[model samples]
Target: MKIKTLIVDDEPHAIEIIETYVGNFPEIELVATCNSAIEAFQILQKDRIDLLFLDIKMPGLLGTELVRTLKNPPKVIFTTAYQDYALEGFDLNAVDYLLKPIPFNRFLKAMEKVFDGYRPINRQIVSVQTDQNKSENFIYLRVDRKTVKINVRDIYWLESLKDYIKVVLADRTLVSKQKISVLAELLPESLFLRIHRSFIVAVDKIDSYHSYAIEILGKELPIGRNYKDACRQRLQN
Candidate 1:
């Protein structure tokens, strides 16, 4: 079943961009675009929406406020120009938070997380068919409006910045709006380990380590207390 989606934003151009991006994914169907929270609330009363693209700074009855009143809110991806609301958005268990002028790649990555959340319930339908077709040496990442190819071996580590992750390579870094947990699943388990809640270090990238931190690429990353035992065992190998 396609995910029923709603785009709630005051800007016509913003709604248009999201409508265009939603078309790229076959699993999502655009239901409606409301210019205000009041209109969106009315639509919600009559429609069953699975995903929501919300703008937090709407004039009255703010997007955040609208979600606060919903007993069972749909998975939300906040698209706005302001960055301050990111922490609050995640506190509401939002699927993703995006900053504007939203890039298509970021939009795609956010949809990926939304799809990942529904994967268990709709496993057969939501699972990426490319997983079966692709080889182990490389992976596809939604980076800047295109699904860019990356060699897994070139990745030094992954740093999580709340709603996004930085893929550190030897020469450059690629940032994508993907959760750390989601990105971790894409990486080969044997070669990667979550040393901290916000960090994933390549097994071969470790230069040295103590009980407190693991050194990678001349930088020391703290080992989360909960992840200490696992990090110790994995890095020692």
Candidate 2:
């Protein structure tokens, strides 16, 4: 069964990001995108939406206010730039509160909640398909205002630069305006290892390693204290 979904946000770019993420899930059927709470309210009265991706702050009517007005509101995942609205969002029984520039990994976590709570019958099938295909061999990343596809096997290592991540490949490096933690989530766990807060290395690309650091392409990257145990376990097996 398809999960009828609606996205309500004033920002066109924000809506676009959500739309792209939603497209990955075959079970979700996006009903519409609304630019305002008033516009969304109109659609809610007529449609049978199972899930809502709602932006908290709007021009006039707030997303929370619109939810309150509904006699039986659909499962909501609140999206906002401000962190202040988190408490209020939870009070309204939101499935999740997403910050702006939502990471695909974070969005996946929120969607897991929706799937678990709303549809247990299709859980096994969804999980199997999602695990099989989600970022199987390549991933699309925004670089220089365009989406670039990077082969997963081409990656040697990744370096985090605050708000940006440097993707090091066999022949070249591509800098993307995304968190390394977010990019890590997109890669296959069997092929990658997060050795430090600022670094993630391709497991197969490692030339050598010790208790302290990992050697990749003749460069030594320190293993974070918190990640040492997991790193050791992953490399050993």
Candidate 3:
């Protein structure tokens, strides 16, 4: 019933603040407080941590790098003094990003997200068969005043239409009044690529690519100049 948690920070004061905040949450149990990423890794190897409060910069291994090494990492709440790492943290699907000096109320808000994300919801589960004919991940979207489950494999591409985004599937399209950037963060980055400012394509759905554009199901999507290099790199390898 308790969420086993770890706090990894180089600063003693930072660790103490997190410890004090953790004490206020009855559902959270602080199992370990590590001063370095190296120590955190060792603890993670032997323990089952439900949540991790990780600091970005450390002496030997940065918190972000340490997280990349894990095959099945726990829900992470990144704590950092600098806002520069926020994008990277989000890309890693972190539970939350806490900027120092962290307020107690802000820390509590982050903990709430951990529960909201990991806790199970009572609903009809949607399924999808992938190219390999195996069942894969599903995402929940709010549509028509209810939460609708959509399989990730069914999504061909996403197009941004100003304030709203069109989720294009094999058979139909669904429109949601959500920012493309926030929606992109919810998707698996390895399976999807932001090929343009207004488009995100499923990498597997891509048929062919050139310097200027990519071909997907007989449609040519122009590769934005700013994203051209990154898109080319992902497509190549």
Candidate 4:
């Protein structure tokens, strides 16, 4: 069953980001987007929305206030720039409270919580595999409006850009909206190494390494002071 979703945010860019992320999930169907709490409240009265991506601060009525008015509210994931509203958002029983400039992976985690409530009876079984069989693994990234699948083996390195990550491939580079930490967690530990706070490199892609830097694709990336010990250990092995 597709989850009927609605996005309510004052900022157009915020709504666009959420919309792009939501589009990647085939299980979710975005119903509408509203710029104000009052506009969203009107839709809630008539439509049966399964999920709501609501922004807390609006001009007139707050997103939290809108939820309070609904006797039978849908599952809500609150999005806001302020951390002060987190306690209040959770007190109202929100599924998740996302801060602005939301990472794609964080948004993905929030959606997973929503899916837990409506788990399918015939869930697909995943086959168990050994570490040696993980070379075929790949991950889907939200690039522009489409989700792009990237093979783990093709990745040369990854560079952190605050809220985004630049994924360096063998032939091309793709900039994705996600935190490097989140991507690091997804990658297989044996094949990838975090060489610095701003960079992660595929172990196999490194041509040479010294005390302070690593050479890959004829370019050098610095090794972070804290990660020097671990980087040396991984590369040496």
Which candidate's TM-score is highest?
A: 4
Q: Determine which window of 10 residues in candidate 2 has minimal summed lDDT.
A: 123-132
TM-score (C-alpha) between model 3 and the true structure: 0.50
Q: For candidate 2, lDDT tens digit of each residue in 6-57?
A: 9999997788678767766767899999999999999999999999999989
Q: Encode model 4's per-residue lDDT on 79-153: one tens digit a residue.
A: 999999999999999999999767555676787788799877333222222243452376567788567878788
Q: For model 1, which pairs clash?
A: none
TM-score of 1: 0.52
TM-scores, one per candidate: 0.52, 0.56, 0.50, 0.58
- Superposed by TM-score, candidate 3 places the C-alpha of residue 3 at a distance from the truth, in angstroms, of 0.5
Clashes of each: 0, 0, 0, 0
Alpha-carbon RMSD, candidate 3: 13.6
* Per-model CA lDDT versus the true structure: 0.81, 0.85, 0.81, 0.85
Models sorted by TM-score, best on top: 4, 2, 1, 3
Model 2 alpha-carbon drift over 4 Å, by segment: 123-237
Off by over 4 Å in 4: 121-146, 149-237
Which pairs of residues have clashing backbones in candidate 3?
Answer: none
Candidate 2: Cα lDDT at 48? 97
Give me candidate 4's TM-score against the actual structure: 0.58
